[model samples]
Target: MTDSATSVFEADLPTLDYGLTDPPQQIYPQFRAAQQAAPVALGPIGPEILSYEMARTVLRDPRFVIPPGIHLSAHGITSGPLWDRVTRSILNMEGDEHRRLRGLVSRAFTPRATARMHDTIGTVINELIDDATARRSCEFVGDIARPYPIPIICALLGAPREEWQQFSRWAEDIFKIVSFDCDLAAEEPVVLAAWDEFDAYIDTMIAQRRRQLTDDLLSELIRIEDSGDRLNAAEVRMLAFSILLAGTDTTRSQLAASMQVLCEHPEQWALLRDQPELAMRAVEETMRHSPSMCSTVRSAGQDITLGELTFPAGTFIVVNTYAANRDATVYDDPERFDITRAAPPPILTFGGGVHYCLGANLARLELSEALKILAARVPDARCVGEVPWKPLLGLSGPVRLPMELCR
Candidate 1:
């Protein structure tokens, strides 16, 4: 085993800048270089410093644990009142606790259940695109992708439609604070305010639902019973925060990126239009091309050996999904954006193993529905101006994707 003093370990990750001009290309080379030089290395730079990985060792290794405190500290978030609620999330849990909570939440995300939302999801997409058609030109992110997630999530959570925009505002800021690339110093106030507001709003909603339960996920979760036990208020709050944060920003970013890619690759756009049946394929391809999450970190649970290097317990493991998906060894001409490229293996856009994203099905539904509607309505839509892509660490893709709908 390699000793911590002189092992080929790398640290200094938080400060690593893959420059935002064209981040995908900029970061891909660095990740590929890291994979070759040392699968694990010091993070680029930052506090709570640790190592990062760019290989399949993450799946084979069993030493990595998802301890919430370690993960938060890695991002420079110190122990505080806010950290308590933040760490209670499923993403931070492991062992029995993780499995137990994940089981209950998994029920809401099963493929069969998500399939039931197709019609409603399609309706939202059609309405948004229809409105865009009338406008002729709009910022695809703000107008369509951004607004679409609210109604879908609101319906799922039993939140009222009248409060959609308010929730959207809260959801946006709340997720931003937690994202890897967030400027914690600047966004702390906004995030705290958003959480306070979300908590107050949810308390009112929960009280109302208790008085009159409905078919929404929130109401349903309230009534869910397992082994003669039900979820408490704190658990409900954590679940609500997870769903809103997980469901909204990722979906919005993916949808906007899909449109941006389609606009860039008109030939592929023509193919999608010609074969509307390939909407699912298009969604997967878009995810491969422009993933929402750039990376996820796991801590070594024990001394583990992989390749020629050994990771000590408590080491950080970084999985670069964007780089992994684009690895030339994994896919032919990985740089090309081909929706109809002979069915490819499931991409890591949603993740893999026990911690795969719970909202995968919902995201697929939203993307499929969005593309189906957009392709049918504005098949000739094109980029109208410069788009702004956010350099969020954990969350990524375009922030402002302006486009002009075909006349």
Candidate 2:
């Protein structure tokens, strides 16, 4: 932590309004103000926690658990039967159930499994880049970013290639339910319908897999055992849905955001072009600088006190990962986009502790390969239009990125 950064924490903190619709850059000032004031700030939803140390403590502490279903219901957002089933999967589980399910699925995402897909991922990236750059001027999100991740995940799960597009649409609709400023009342019906469709699709796939199992992540998940226990049909369906939900749009948005960042910083692009091994470093910096998922919501399992605030059991806690990643106390000139910065401690872009993102290795593999391929194939690519930002609460990224590729 720098001296100037130390001074920031010493200043009197200001009460800040947590706005869902404001762009992250616009909202960061308030985040800095709140972090300086205290570890946690009272917001409309409940208490919001900033600062790296406090945020990590809240995430790892068992006292802060997954939000209760009723709490989410109060917000007028329901996951319907399918998502309800998914919630029953690892995402909302705790204690023994979470441990069992996570252990079973952990094998599928091990580093070795993820590494085996390197050539496959590179091939997919090249194909997408070929199609995207063939036009010279392209909408990067729709052409490259959006289409890339879905099939890779589908291939990993043994999902039929023909249905990838439909699954992608379903994932997008399901995500709207979780967006910060979403009007739950208006979007609830559509979200429910999408879940129903997704549930039916997954059910059929599960049945098919049972009849003739394949060598894929989904099949492995179905048969995976922990202490001689296996996931049931509903559990398998839910796990598959959870994987699709977490893997698809988030990776797409992150890739798009990273590309936009590189296009804006041509020198960084040149750096990567000159030294391809820095691709992974660039991905990490992009994740640190402009993470797709910004904040995560958790409920206090019991009364807890930390840094001048006492959160009662059931109190809603929002962990501001974006703020923590940019805290100057932790990073020198934290806001500047620098890929060469000394490797700092892991950022909270992926939640830590028991709930650390299960697909993190897969995400890293996809991100690094995406950067490497782009640096090699589209070295001269440049942003061509005003990038439209996605107005989402828990996640941040570009929704539309137009780029011109010079061959």
Candidate 3:
């Protein structure tokens, strides 16, 4: 695979987020318009990257797998801190290993399991609303969106709810790569320290789970028997790490974003308030319109044909989910935020195929609970100030979403 470089592509191309810059909505319209004009655009942001339909092509092509390339290694995306123990979970593994790990986690992330958590999730949502109401105004990202995902994840993993704060801190620090560069000279120590702390936490959990069995995902994974294929200690840690981080960060952002969108479109809020069944549709529509993720990177495994272009093996392809969801061809009046639209299935927010998000069910549950609580309790909640957003291009989320509580 081609290593990320400083100079390889044309300079005329508009440079996108390089771990900096904000206003992705504006950036996206310009980029999508360009891609629609020419599907295969050379990298302007970093190295010789292929964006647009080339992204869809790579995503659809079976030969262009996600692992074993510059995308995975250069990015330092091991399952968890214990790199050796769990080398082949779904997110990082290729071939048989990938399928095997995915199958195990898939069971825990089933529709039934996610559905069952809603009662507890609703309780959490209510508690958050109660807390917000006491304050009259609060930072939704820190107060609500931040805490909502952890307890559900803790419940699923069978971890202690008391330890949720520690997990939250580690997860936040670890994912700050979105805000700060991992490759920076001064960042090495901080990243390494965070990795070490989380790795220790997972190691301790795995060791504890081994001794005392329970119904949590870690214990369930420990009990799994594939005869010839079983998860080792390191693999278990990474799997847990991946699920916790991915599950928490992405959902939290979207949970907060859902509130932002609702606040922006008070009319949509009124419709959902009047008919709560529309909550799910609004969640789906909101995700499609303004997803939490900016883009996902995949390395071209074999020489692949994506539409009109031919990508060589090892090409680092940036799948701009934001662009794909807003494609005028796929979405009618794509720019307009209309939850009432009769949209088709398979929204791109959780992604698609084998790589689809494992916690998508829980995410939906969280959003549903939040909206239900907001509609019932904080119907008059509105943005108190301009939403403070991180400028990182790869992942765009509100750093602080302050909202006023109205009776």
What Cα-based lDDT does every candidate model obtain?
0.72, 0.79, 0.68
Evaluate residue 356 in candidate 3 and report its C-alpha lDDT on the 0 to 100 scale. Answer: 74
Off by over 4 Å in 1: 2-6, 10-22, 32-62, 67-76, 179-190, 207-212
Once fitted onto the true fold, the runs of candidate 2 whose alpha carbons sit more than 4 angstroms away are 1-13, 69-75, 78-83, 179-197
> Can you write out model 1's per-residue Cα lDDT over 1-407, one digit (the tens) per residue?
65443333553222345443345645665666654443344544321111123344474344566657543564577777557767777767777877777777776666886776677788788888778889898889888988888888877787766878888789878876556665765676788889989988887778888899976777766777778767777677788888887788788888888889988999888888888888899999988877766666677788766655566777666666776776666678877899997967668767666778888888888888788778878889899778777663556788798898985
Write candidate 3's Cα lDDT for 189-302 as tens digits.
565577678778878888898999876778877777665667888778778777775787778888887789888999988888888888888888888777777666676677
Per-residue C-alpha lDDT of model 2 across residues 12-48, encoded as one tens digit per residue: 4456675656667677888877776676666556667
Off by over 4 Å in 3: 1-20, 46-56, 67-90, 176-213, 226-229
Q: Which of the predicted structures, 1 or 2, would earn the higher TM-score when compared with the native?
A: 2
Q: Global lDDT for candidate 3?
A: 0.68
Cα-based lDDT at residue 386, candidate 3 = 82
User: Where does the lowest 10-residue lDDT sum fall in candidate 1?
Assistant: 45-54
Tell me the TM-score of each prediction against the true structure.
0.86, 0.88, 0.83
lDDT ranking, best first: 2, 1, 3
Q: What TM-score should be assigned to candidate 3? A: 0.83
- Lowest lDDT sum, 10 consecutive residues, model 2, at 1-10
